[model samples]
Target chain A: MADHEIVIAGFGGQGLLFAGKVLAYAGLLEGRELSWLPSYGPEMRGGTANCNVILSDTPVGSPIVQHPNVLVVMNAPSLDKYEPLVAPGGKIFVDSTLVTRKVERTDVDVFYVPATQMAADRGMHDLANMVLLGTVLRETGCVGEETIDEALRHVIPARKAHLFDANKAAIEAGKGYVSAA
Target chain B: MKEKVLMKGNEAIAEAAILAGCRHYFGYPITPQTEVAAYMAKKMPKIGGTFLQAESEIAAINMVYGVASTGKPSMTSSSSPGISLKCEGISYLAGADLPALIVDVQRGGPGLGGIQPSQSDYFLATRGPGHGDFHVLVFAPASVQEMADLTGRALHLAWKYRMPAMLLADGTMGQMMEPVELPEEHEAFGTDNPWAAVGTGMKRPHNIINSLELSPERLEEKNVERFERYAEIEKNECAWEEYRMEDAEICIVSYGITARISRNAIVAARAEGIKVGMIRPITLWPFPAEPLLAAADKVDSFLCVELNMGQMKDDLELAIRCRKPVDLCYRVGGMIPTSDEVLDHIRALAEGGR
Candidate 1:
């Protein structure tokens, strides 16, 4: 099987790194080789945050993905920065509510999900990241949805356990958007 | 007892050290490596272990000296600049024939350079961490799992050889997350070595744990004994990994995070019909010279990749005895070389561009 190199980018508070962690956990739950590398610095809060997630059948090298096969941009800046870097035939998932600009790349499949607006509509304000993640999973089928559900249990700290249901709803809404598209 | 959990490399090192029976941890906070000290700080108190954030790196290493003298496993963690400050203490540990673990979660630097990931301290780690006729066993863990596994192994080696051992990692590994199968925890603060300074009483003579020897002859003897132990370690403890090397013409030599990058580069090179492979040195102190030399015999050329200005390139040349052309592809300070850049180098060498 071909390896999956994914780049998740957004503002720090958008749970970009947490989304990557959930994806990586899903891969691990399936007993696949995976790595998660986050852009770590003092500006981790309200700053540009990004992470690379590689899920492969073989050993992964260089957890820093330069030209990711899959890119999830949760904000305008993330979309502007990473859209061009996605591989020619790669897939990109954008949060359309915040990123009003259209994707310019015609070579790749682009899914414009209003992740934040949809999450807020469902009264799950903090799960925009999971909505985008669900859309990516639906498009790529990198890991099963059940695996992601199982992964959520691990990534969400016990103190935040109450958010699991809303997070799951956001993910389902995302998949629903993709199917509707 | 095989259970896997997602963990950061720095935290894994702390957990591994605890599992290896280490009870004393002394360290000052440094970026890229602070998690190590933090993990110990949180867990040690509950386990009845000692975790003291020393005033400085020098004090931390000396605390290691004091604990190691008791023959109980002790550790100290730091980054590049902090490790530099602990050099005097390291040399003292070496001269005193003490066993302890020192972890350098390396960051960019000659002096307070950057907190970003870097392997620029290769010379300090493998060549000379301190002044003197001495060497510390250096283990370069390429993954979070290895970060944990190697720390445990390093503690065992330090105790067995009565020498200081180092886990030479970088900021990337420390920060990255991966699934790791943790080892079972051992009883903390336990040591059976007869030389411990616990107490002599009527059973044996008092044990002296001092590095200072006034007489030249006595110091020379001590140095010779340490060198002999080093030779034995060289024979028995050199560790390395070979990937897709059976039919390759070019060999890429790397360690730690750079090795991880090379693995991807090699796969890309193979996809492009470039017959390239890699040899990752797991143990940097023993240097994996034998395996490197063996690879040198089969491969046409060798390319050494690192996050430094080509420190391991020299070791590659020395190991191969300058038999083949050994070239270098490197990034200095905190920048990481992309897989494409490394593959470009491999492609150039494959096409005889040299």
Candidate 2:
């Protein structure tokens, strides 16, 4: 809880950046200093995109996170691209559905969650990122569990706001994936 | 202070401007930057500020020019192509030495490029945004907070210098949401313009705010007098932030969204055991040359990463003196530079000594 830097990366369609934004928003609710920056461009059409979120007890110096205490890989290329650079002891939550390849780094704890399959099984196909969020919550407890669900509710645009229950179920299921592991 | 609000970049800039005591808002709707107008539309009426959505970007800026002539405080915003439309108006404002704030939440463009984040307008914004030996005080915000903060400062400086000020932001900085703490409404102190068109009380000579001068020597004198303000802006208004550069061997130069991306790159590069830091220019026009030039002397190599081919890098070479290699790595045509991509360039600088 001192100061956490986290990067959530996945394909452009995935809510990797949204998830990062929610974390930053939740941090704001906690009155913690924070910044969230997302990558943009045509690469978003098919390739990987990520968001950098930094939560600090002090005034956050640079909004750009250089080395993250946590890395959340929601797709294969995300893990493929960022795994090698994670700081020692930094944790990673890898989505098994998108990331078929096992992680090579053994220095840090790696949680393999089939968040996509779990969300699909739970009747919410697009809640994998939330599931990953839940896994992140269980592993680090960076933000309060109760606030996260509320953060998700408040952060999503109103048009998609009604998907709350399924998303909540997906996150709980995501935690279960890691808990059962 | 008003409540801490979760606001998009454009909304933040508009509300921030109001907090800075700006009473006139003129703009046309442009993608990414439209939220500025929407927010102003909703709040300006409530707060007794004037909000005018003009027929076009040209009309909007000229309206800004007219309001600025009254010398209270006024602003206009547009995207890249739309900003191009405002350049002529900006030139006139500069020539008249009028104090005004202009925000460009730049989208991709040479001509209606794309409705995505882009720093391609770096040249258009920094290198005399309009025409005829004119300059703008261009402030670039790396995060939404800086966007809010600089918007207020832009207003204050515009009034103080009697010059045009621009917030040179891009789409990512416009659409992204962040929490902002708005200052007290009346904290923004207003300036008095004795020459304002606002009722000369029928006592003083009628004030004429004009960019035109009939005599050749008179116009040249006017241009020279205006440049004296530009020199003051350079000396007094240049701002930037440097991170971990005390011993940085490899450095990256960036601004706005590219600045944020470079931060991630610096960290990723550090994990790869490379010593790297990012220097972000908060003011695009003044360009923050001193810090960059000092780093140029310190770091073995510098990489200027942007969403464009290499515009900001051109400035770094000019300002930083390029004692070491100042290379440019970029993506374009509505594409953004990734941290990994930037790290690739940083890594090259580390290993190959570029």
Candidate 3:
């Protein structure tokens, strides 16, 4: 990756932190330079949250990014908070069912996947972040499919080992949504 | 020592302290430095060490006092405001002349300052923390590796000086990631600390670790004796590093995390054909006055940049004691002054010509 910057945002319970950690771990697996900084002030205790994921083939500068190349907005607040900060010709993946507000910008590509409805169809409400991750991997080709699978294997600790099948199914459902879009 | 691990400053200190035979750690959670307590919480049980999350900073340092009185390597850590609460116990520790390692990974503060790294506690660390004329051996480490190195050194110095020792760091130093090499493990793990309150065990006289004595004259003797030890420490334990000062006309002096920022400024100033260098004092208590005095004789001027309103600059002027006053460059409240900002001050000072 030359410069792959990701912004994942949502309310506190939406697994935004876990999704960002997986991306950072994927960068670690690829042996690339990366930084994972979370919105730690008011966004910490069950409030709206966001994390910045930056991966580079070389050393990264300051970890904070004012303009991210890709955004995965999980809620309306996140969409409203981060929509305009997307770079020109960047991608915005919004949960169509949750994020009702549409982007006004014409230069960037926006995809409304109704990801929560898709997860509900698959009976995996908690796997929304995984679905979004799969769509991001497929659409942006940010990381190879094989590398992401390997990264997911280590992201969840051994104590939660039994949830693997659900996570994989979530990824497949998200991949299917990307293809449909 | 074997593998080169990229570690945060907090985790490096926790691991190094364990290797240095410190098995008991008590701390309360504070930002930027909480990782130190968390890392110990995770690993201490596996290594048979004790990690306690105290209810308050006051309780935490007193818990440290309890453990340190037993004479095993024991420690506690906190940030600026939390450290202020622990000052009473630290004063008691000093009055009793007990050896313990207290780490202040300082955050910006007069009260609840932002959690962005700061070197604001220079005066609190170097001068006596609480009431009375007691001094702690304060060590300032500039890098993550130095965090590990100086933790081990701080433990050793606490034992040597028979007083409380502190590793004073800033939030940036606590939160940053860097590569570090741990010192090789040796046979000192089981050695008995001479002052530990490990009870005489029915073989020798019973020990009491207390700061209070009924008589005032004896307390005065303790005061004079501690000062004598301070004199000895000043003689033997002063540490400083000088960079590119051979032909430097302006010296940029900083320590803790600010020194790293100034190191960058020093390089840029030199690239712009300015004769600016940096003098970093590794130990803040001794204050490295001799080196500054010597530098004053060599250089045309000196600039001290700190995270507080001229805390360390106060010491620099006292140390140099020159006809010309030292220039102060400072930032407060968790803000990091960039290299360009510091270099601008150096340029302006050079142009101002004393």
lDDT of 2 at A9: 91
lDDT of 2 by residue, A13-113 (tens): 88887788778878878877776767666656768788888788876544555667799998787887888878789888888888888888878888888
Q: Score residue B59 of candidate 1 by CA lDDT.
A: 99
Model 3: per-residue Cα lDDT over B1-354, one tens digit each: 265454667888998888888888999998878989999999999988899999999998898888778776789999999999999999999998888899999887889877767788888888889988999999998877789999998888887777899999887667655446786754222357655668777888778889997789988898999999999999999999998888888988898767876876787788988898888999998789998888888788889888889988778888889745578888889777766678899988788774
Superior by TM-score: candidate 1 or candidate 3 = 1
Q: Clashing residue pairs in candidate 1, if any?
A: none
Candidate 3 lands at a TM-score of 0.75
Question: Model 3, residue A28: what's the lDDT?
Answer: 66
RMSD after CA superposition, every candidate: 2.0, 4.7, 5.2
Model 3 C-alpha lDDT per residue in residues A1-181, reported as the tens digit of each score: 4587789998887888778777776776666776665655445677888887778886554444557889999888888888888889899998877887787888998877777888888888878888888788778877667777666777777998788888888887778775333
| Cα-based TM-score, every candidate | 0.96, 0.79, 0.75
Query: Which predicted model would earn the best TM-score?
Result: 1
List ranges where model 3 is wrong by over 4 Å: A1-39, A45-181, B186-190, B323-325
The DockQ assigned to candidate 1 is 0.72
Off by over 4 Å in 1: A178-181, B186-190
Q: Per-residue lDDT of B1-354 in model 1, one digit per residue for the tens?
A: 586788899999999999988989999999999999999999999999999999999999999999999889999999999999999999999988899999999999888999899999999989758999899999999999999989999998998898899999999999999889998776433358887888887788899889999999998998998899999999999999999998989999999999999998998899989898888999999998988888888989999999998888898899999999988889888999999899989988988944
Alpha carbon lDDT of each predicted model: 0.90, 0.83, 0.82
How big is the positional error of residue A48 in model 1, measured in Å on the Cα after superposition? 1.4
| Candidate 2: tens digits of C-alpha lDDT, residues B2-22 | 557667788889988998888
